[model samples]
Target: MEQIVGSGKFTYDVNENWAHVPPGIEMKPAAVAVDSRDRVFCFNRSNEHPVLIFDSNGDFLMSWGAGMFRYPHAIRFDAQDRVWLTDEHHQQFMQFTSDGKLLRTIGEKGHRSETGVPEDDFSSQAWRQVTHGGGPFNLPTDIVVVPNGDMYMTDGYGNARVHKFSADGRHQFSWGEPGTGPGQFNLPHGIWYDRRGRLLVADRENNRVQVFDLDGNLLTIWPTELIGPAFFYVDDEDTVYIPEHNAGMFSIVTLDGERLARWGAPIHKSIHGVWGDSRRNIYVVQPGEWGRVRRIVKYTRR
Candidate 1:
């Protein structure tokens, strides 16, 4: 045995630093996503090559988005395989061809809402400053597009709300406010559509993942088992891979909010992003202080 980690059938053989960029490239890995073709994309908060692509065998395919974003926050793919990206400092949602050609952009570049937090400040506790829910983004975090072409982005960090858009990228409506009550969020960091067509919002500061209908009705909440999730990636089987930002743990849970497998050390902080490939392998990325997560890890399926 190769020192398996995780639990139950979701165990894996850990392969740390599975990929590397050329000399002088910085990958403060912010978020990660896997395409249908088995290519893994690491979206980082780096000035150079913000997007790093790799094959399932851990081969460096290519790098893109050099100087394209101030701080690349999230990455997701549509059914057509187009890349959907979000920028924190820039405060915009971006669309691109799979090869990294820009197709469109949303939101005002460098314009943030009236959240108490300033555009330049990114302290972890800044959520306390979000007095009210604002517009499209203020350090926007993650984006998810459903089958009907409706999109949802977790406008967290500087603001506490989720913005929904139509297939054409028009703002349909927005929901949530700064609070601990149901339908309210403290820091709605990550987002995804569950297998049952319900909306799942990672209410990070409140230490729970709140599920809602598309109309913004609160359904249920998944309290952190002493973990604060930063992002959520749902696999084909409806298992959720959550990277706990506060406790530095990785949790594999089900649609019913049951933890299938959870693992990590206390020293690990900001396990910011997670993605599962078709081969049952899991990809994890961390965005902490520089010189951390020197190489992103791939948890090979056991």
Candidate 2:
């Protein structure tokens, strides 16, 4: 029997084998993005094939970035269809042409910021000691380029901060610290800009989504208890799709943060990333346990 997920107008049919991998080629997709041509790109952790490209019909197209990344954390396409990737393990972010040519790189490779205290310090540590608007990145998890060419990155893992930069790769300003306050973040995992140009951050560890203006002022925060949001995909109609790892489900919400729908495999807790293309087909990356099928599943609206 064909399994279906979601409800109402958001329901979809799951295609587990949407894209086939060659024999002996293991992949654990860390992030996913679609370009203007609807070409799907999967950023995987494997050094042998760090980036995998696929056509809209799920056919494998090409692979690149081998021996060029330590950890493929996130992928996003700019307005010009250029690709931007973040390597968390290497603590660097890079830009590439659509044809896989390196354009620019940011951050000092393999170096972590001297700031940020471990979990043991808890909330007692001074905010300045943990986050001082450091340079480059400590361990960036995700990035987004605004329409004006300004860039923002969630400096994750080693540093709890969000850095803003120019299109030409100059750091402009940064904000956030390690705490539970209004401007603080635990693990600001995923980020996206809405049509109104407001920034929405998936404050993963805090189990909430924080909204802020481009200038770093906290606007609002929506509590999403039990849903550890790992990533986001805001559709053309302003619908937000969040891959919640802790809840093992996708939480569908509106631009104003209203929960509209939720669905996923209740027995599985592997959904780590999500993206949707022009046709409204949703793609999710499930990095299943050790030997399981670490694959990207396509959900077509029924």
Candidate 3:
């Protein structure tokens, strides 16, 4: 495993070597996304610059997207290399270019509604409530891009549902409800489409990951023995990494839901997100102290 720490303009790598850090940018980074060029993008709330770019070796590049985000919680890279971000407080999903150019924004701010009733039981209505006619979002936490360029967002917190959008930001379909049933979710915080294009939702408060098809069919569920399974990441090898916020650690499981390896220090009060790089280095994000003292720790196979 390797570790790196950054504060103000100073960054120290695993060997305690001084590394290049961006200037005039500081925030408790809650999420990170790496591009195909290996450039790192850090998303944090405090920095007026919501997105900070850095080279693989920690060289300071540039920063942008100021004044556009409200509690930017997670950042992800799409197949086309475009960047997608979730603003939980703003209740919206945003797309940006690699250079931080705002491409599109979906969802309305401060709009709230009750959806997924028997009348709107079809998956399509859930998508409309989030994308078309501008229905209110309770809190949108995470986003993922499908293999075909569509997008899937977890509408958690206030509302329990998942909304899908086409590549052009059109509402495609949506599913989920605020129950503990097979297709229900309690704080569906993080979502991702696996290699097979199957959707996996981290039913956070429920402590399980519910698998569903593109059409909202409940396929399977992976129950976690721990509480608060907040986020999930499926690797190219079909292994799943799940981070439990309550436990302050992450577990690696097979696609079939068998526990493999687990690692972390109990010192982490809350683990929020997880991501893996090309080299299979696992990165965990912990947002702490009102975003004042966040940390990203990298782990590797022992």
Residue-pair clashes per prediction, in order, are 0, 0, 2
Q: What clash pairs does model 1 have?
A: none
- Candidate 2 residue 126 Cα shift, in angstroms, is 18
Report the error of model 3 at residue 92, Å.
Answer: 1.2
Best candidate, TM-score-wise? 1
What TM-score does prediction 3 earn? 0.81
Q: Which stretches of candidate 2 lie over 4 Å from their true place?
A: 117-135, 223-226, 287-293
Judging by lDDT, tell me the better candidate of 1 and 2. 1
Candidate 2: count the clashes: 0
lDDT of 2 by residue, 195-220 (tens): 99899998777778899999989998
Structural RMSD, model 2: 3.7
lDDT of 1 by residue, 1-302 (tens): 35578877988998775775667876677788899998999897787789989898778888888888987778888889999998977889999998999998888998888877866677667778888888887888888888998888899889999999998989988999999898899889889998799988888878889999898888988754536788888878888888888887888888878888888865667678788888989888853333456347789987
Scored by lDDT, model 1 comes in at 0.83
Q: 251 in model 2: Cα distance from truth in Å?
A: 0.9
State the lDDT of candidate 3 residue by residue for 53-93, as single tens digits. Answer: 76655567888888887677888888889998888777788
lDDT per prediction? 0.83, 0.80, 0.70
Structure candidate 2, residue pairs in collision: none
Candidate achieving the largest lDDT = 1
What is the clash count of model 1?
Answer: 0
